[model samples]
Structure formats: C-alpha cells, structure tokens
Target: MTARRRWSTEEILDAAAELLRTSDAESFSVRKLAAALGTDSSSLYRHFRSKTELLRAVADRILLAAMDSYRPEGDWKQRIMSLAQRVREAFGQQPQLAAVWGRHASSGTGSRLVMEEILQALRASGLPDEEIPTRYHRIAVLLAALIAAEAGVSAITPEEYEQGMELFRVAVLGADPGRFPALSHFARDVRPLGADRHAAFEEILATQLAHIETAMRSR
Candidate 1:
C-alpha cells in the first residue's frame, strides 16, 4: 500500500495566503481550502486547529514576506517612510490579509521583528532612549491608519466612493466655515483627502518623528 503524502505547515499556510490574496476572506472556508489543495478538510485540522489560527498563520506569512523586502539605508525619517510605503504596498496587494493583519494583536514573532527593526532604526538616529517607546507608539498609530485607509479604499465602488467623498466635503464645509476657512474654501478639493493616502501617511509619520526627535534633544 502506498503512504499518503502529508502536507507541511508552510504548504498549508501558503495555500491559505493565496486564497486570501485572490479572493475575499469571507470565501476562505476549510472546505474550500481543502478543495483548492486537493486534500480533506480533516488534514488541515492537523496543521491548524482552528480557522482563526490558520488565518493568523496566513497573515504572519504574508507580513513576513513584506518585511523581508524592506531595505532602507537612510536617516530614520526616510527609512520609516520607505518602510511605511512597503507596508502599504504589501497590504494593498493582499487586502483581505491586510484586514486580518491589522486586527491581530502585535504579539507574533513577525510583528515583533517589524517593530524591532523600526525601533532599531530610530535608535540609530539619536532618538533618546526614554522616548523610544513614544516613537514606536506614533509609528504604530500611523501603520494602523494606513491599513484602515487601504481597507476603506478597497471596500467601496469607485462611483460610490466618489459620491461619498463629495458628501463628506459638503458636510465639512457646512460646519463652522469661519473656524475652518481654508477647509471651506478648498472643500471641493478636500473631499476626504483620499489621493495617495500612503504618501499622506508617510508625511504624517515623518512629521511626528521629527517632532519627537526635537523634543527629546531639548529635554
């Protein structure tokens, strides 16, 4: 009798990640995955005890792939911007995975590695030791914002999204024009500020890092 070939954990994860990349997460069922892999769903259970665990594994795999491609040799601000852009591209490529990656607690090894790299870069740039945590907090916030923006952009139809942006502009302009004069004047152009969100996020990250560096040096 011939023995059945067992699938490795990495193989299962790769299959799951591909599923998420090509389709929505809603379509990622064990049965569907098994069918795609030409195996029984029971076989998958041997590798992943639950769907959540499998999803996390898939998220980790994709995130690590993203981190592997990050290469920055510049000042902390430039490095961070480059890193942020890589992250944005990664999540954009696999949007369903992005939603899962964004929600998971940053406790996994992959998550830790990414954070450690960011912290190391910041430390190398002369950010004070005491302020390192604050710098990371800012980076985390910017990362979360980028993921959220990408997710939002992926969820809406182009026409509906455009109409929604127009509605947002009207609402903002309707609010205290005297207090937000510039916003009111540019309301048409200010419609939710969705163009090149990753670039906008990079700017925000750079500004925050600069502010932190200045404050730490003063203190």
Candidate 2:
C-alpha cells in the first residue's frame, strides 16, 4: 500500500505564502491552497482546524519572514520607518494575506514580536504610554490598506486600465470647461491611479511618520 503524504506546518505555510504572493486575495481559499499543495483540503485539517486559523498562520509567517533580518538602529523615528517599510514590502508581497492579518488580528509569536518592536520604537519616540496601542492599530490599518490597494492594481489588466483612461479623457474633454475646470485642465496629464502607487504609498507613509515626529515634539 502506498503511504499517505504528511505535510509539515512549515511546508503548508510555505505553500500558503506562495498562493498569497501570486493569487488575488479574493481567490484564496482552502481548496485553492490545498490544490496548490497537491493535497486535499481535508489533509490541511491535520495542521489547522479551520481556514481562518490557516490564514492567520500564513499571515504571521509572512510578516516574520519579512522582518527576519530587522534590527533597530538609528533614530527612533528612523527605526520605526525602517520597520514600516519592511512591513509594507512584506504585506505587499502577499497582498491577499493582508486582509487575513487584519481580520484575525493574529497574535502568533512572530506577530507579537513585530508588535513589540513597533511599540518599542514608539516608546523611544516619546509617544505617551497609553497611546501606543492606538498608534499601532492605526499604522497596521494603513499598511493593510496599502497592501489591498496594491492587490487591486495587480488585478487590473493593462488593456482595461488604458480603456478606463481613454474613457476618463473623453468625459473630461466633453464636459464644459468652465464647470469642470480642474478636470478639464488635468485631463491631458492625469495618470491612472495605479501607475504610481508605490510612490504614493511612500509619500503617504512619509507624511505619517512626519506627523509622529511632530506629535512627539509638541507633547
């Protein structure tokens, strides 16, 4: 008789990470993950009792892998910014898992360690002891939102994006210039939203970090 295949937790997480990295977040499912692993969905239950649990595990692993080499150095704000960038890159690589991270609010060992690092940075920056959690939650949400936005951009086909741009151009040009002056003026130069998303994300994050510094000084 042929022996049944046994999957390790690490092996399953590796497959799940690959799926999150490549597949649209909405397309992720236990069946899909199982298929990717070349095993039946039921087999996964041996390691994870539910899809939610499995997804949380995947999310936790993704963040840890991203911050594996992270060591706090430089100014407090700079350290936080560095960690934030790592967070963004990690979540961006596995966009689908972003939702899972947010949904479960997973506190696996790796994620807890990440939280500690961020909180430590915030403490060093002089954020009030009581305000750290809120700050952390806000930053976490921002990172997740960015990842989701990146996933949305990836889902769009180039042809569709071009078609949308042409449609927008036609609408802006056809409208009365005086009534829609701003749109009319920018129509010729406006770029698609996803075209420069990475830059936009960096700008937004930079602004947020600046706010933290400002808050620290004002307090």
Candidate 3:
C-alpha cells in the first residue's frame, strides 16, 4: 500500500487563501476547510493553533504576495504609484481578503517591509525626516480609500456600477453649477468615456503624493 503524505503548513495556508479569494473570509471555517482538504478539523489545529491563527496566516500569505510584486526603484511618484497599484491589484484579486486586511493590525512582517520600502524611497526623494510619520499616515489613508473604493465597486456588476457612478457624477456636479465648475467638467468627461477607474486612481494617488512630497520639502 502507498503511504499517505501529511499536509504542510504552506499547503493548508494556500487552501485557506484559495477559499478566501473565492469566497468571503467569514465563510471559511476550520471544519469546512478540513472537509475540503479531506481531513478532520483537528488536523488543522495541529498546523494552526486556532481559526484566528489560520486567518492571520492567510493574511500573511496575501501580504507577501503583494510585497513580492512591489518594485520601489524609480522616481518617487512612479514608485509610489507602482506600490499603490500592486496593492490595489492584490486586493482586487482577493476581495474576500479585504475584510481581514482592514481589521488586522499593520504589524506583520510583510506589511512592515512594504512600508519600510515606501518610506525609504520617499526619504531618498528629499522628503524631510520629520515628515516621515505624516507621509506614512497619508499613504495608509490613500491605500484604505483605494481598497474601499475597489471593493465597493466590485460588489456590483460593472455596467450597473458605471451607470450609478454616472448618475452620482451628474447629481454632485449639477448641484451647484458655478461653484463647482471643475466638478461639472469632470462629470462631462466621465459621462462620455466612462472613467477608467484604476487609471484615475493611479493619477489621483500620484498627484496627492507629489503634493505631500512638496510640502515635506518646504518644511
């Protein structure tokens, strides 16, 4: 008879990550995971002390994926844009993982490495050392906003979401014609080509980071 091979921690974590990518994190239970793996729930506890540990492992794996793909060598604006785009892509690929990401403390090794790289790159760009903390905070806010926007948009069909966004554009832009000329122009542009949201996000992030860098240098 052939001997049975035991599952490795990586294998278990990969399975859990697959479940997270395909379904919501809340739906992933040890029992369900074990059943999917052709084992009992007790088997998982040997690898992951508890479900919380399992979730953390899943988060770590996802963060590693994001960090691995990040390339920080370039102009500060380009580097920041690349980092943000990679993050957005990573989350977009696993929307179910967003909830876990949002709730967890940003103290994991993978998370820290990514932040360190970003901070180092920003510092090399002539940004003041004193402003590093503020820059980090702003980057966090920008990432959270991007993740929230992408997750919300993914919840609906693309066509329906586009239509809804168009309607919102009109309402917000048309509310006060003279006071919001740029917004009115924005609505017209969006209504015509339907904004490429990812590209728009990249542009906005680059713009914001540039301003922050400028401000930091002046201080």
Candidate 4:
C-alpha cells in the first residue's frame, strides 16, 4: 500500500485562501476547511491551533505574495510607489483577504519585511526621526482605508454596483440647484479620472507622495 502524503503548511494555507475567496468571513470555519482538504478536523488542528490562527496565517500569506517579487531599485518616492503598487495589485487580486487587514495583527516575517521597506523609504524621505512614527502610521491608515474600500467594491456584484450608481445619480442629478448648488453643478458633469476605483487609488497615492515631497523640500 502507498503511504499517504501529509499536507504541508503552504498547501493548507493555499487551500484556505481559495476557500476564503469564495466564502464570506462568517461562513468560514475549521470544519469546512478540513472538509475542503479531504482531511479530518484533527489533522488541521496539528497545523493550526484554531480557525482564527489559520486565518491570520492565510492573511500573512497574501502579504508574503505581495512582497515576494519586490526588488528595491529607485529613489525614495519611486520605491514607495513601487511598494504601494505591489500591495494594491495583491489586494486587488484577492480583496477578500483585505477584509482581515485591521482585524489581525500580522506578526509574520512578511509583515515585518514590508514594514522595513516602508520605514526605509520614510527615512530616505528625510523626515526627522521624531516624525517617522506618525508619518508611518498615516501611511498605514491610508492604505488600509483604501484597500478596504476596494474590497467592499469587489464584494458587490456589477449589477448591484450599477443599481447603486443609478440611485446615486438620481439623488445627485435631481437635487434642487437652489438648495444644493455646488453638489448639483459638480456632480452633474464631473468625469472620473479613470475606472473609478483605480483612478482614486492612483490619485490618492500620488497626493500622499506629493505631500511627502513637500515635506522633504521644506526641510
């Protein structure tokens, strides 16, 4: 008889991530994962202590994938943009994974390495040592909020998005000009910079980088 192949940690995480992409967070569970793996719950327990632990690993795995191909080769601003782009691409591919960003504190090697690159970029920007932490926090908050927005948009179907946009158009375009002059005028004719989400991400990132550049100039 042939011996059975034990599942590796990477294999387990890959399976878990795929499962998560198809299901909402509330619906994901250890039993379900074990079933998906064609193994007993006890077998999964040997690798992950609990469902929560498994999820954190899966989230970190996404981060690892985001940074796996990063090659640092540019000025501080360019480097920052490259790193941010990689992260955006990764989250865009698996926005479901972004749902766990704030909920889990990723202490994995991947998270640490990413942070290191970010910090290096900040340091290279010539910000004072005293200002680095706050600046870093701001970047973190900005990226988290943007990625969460992308994930929220991804979670909805195209029909739902179109329906919501139709409602928004009705509300904005139909507003009384006398009562809401600016909104009525602006909302009526404005075009998006690009595909709405992608454009917004690029605009916001550029604005943030511009702010950093201004700070560097001031000092």
Taken over the whole model, the C-alpha lDDT of each candidate is: 0.75, 0.78, 0.73, 0.81
Candidate 1's displacement at residue 100, Å, is 1.0
**After superposition, candidate 3 runs with Cα above 4 Å error:** 1-5, 105-107, 155-195
Better of 1 and 4 by TM-score: 4
How high a TM-score does candidate 3 get?
A: 0.72
Better of 1 and 2 by lDDT: 2
Which predicted model would earn the best TM-score?
A: 4
How much does candidate 4 score in TM-score?
0.86
2 against 3, candidate with superior TM-score: 2
Q: Could you tell me every candidate's TM-score relative to the true structure?
A: 0.77, 0.82, 0.72, 0.86
lDDT of 2 by residue, 5-31 (tens): 788999998888788766744677889
Task: List model 4 lDDT by residue over 1-219, tens digit each.
Answer: 865568899899999999989886678898998888887788889998988788888878777888997898788878877887788788778878787765664768778877899889989888887888888888878887788778877877889878877877788888899999998879867642224787788789879889978987876
* Clash count (model 1, backbone only): 0
**Cα lDDT of model 1 by residue, 142-216, tens digit:** 786677667767756789887987788668868677888887778756546567775677677778778877886
Candidate 4 clashing pairs, residues 3+ apart or interchain: none
Positional deviation of residue 42's Cα in model 3 after best superposition, in angstroms: 3.3
Model 4: weakest 10-residue lDDT segment is: 188-197
Q: After superposition, how far is residue 100 of candidate 2 from its true place, in Å?
A: 4.0
Clashing pairs in 2: none
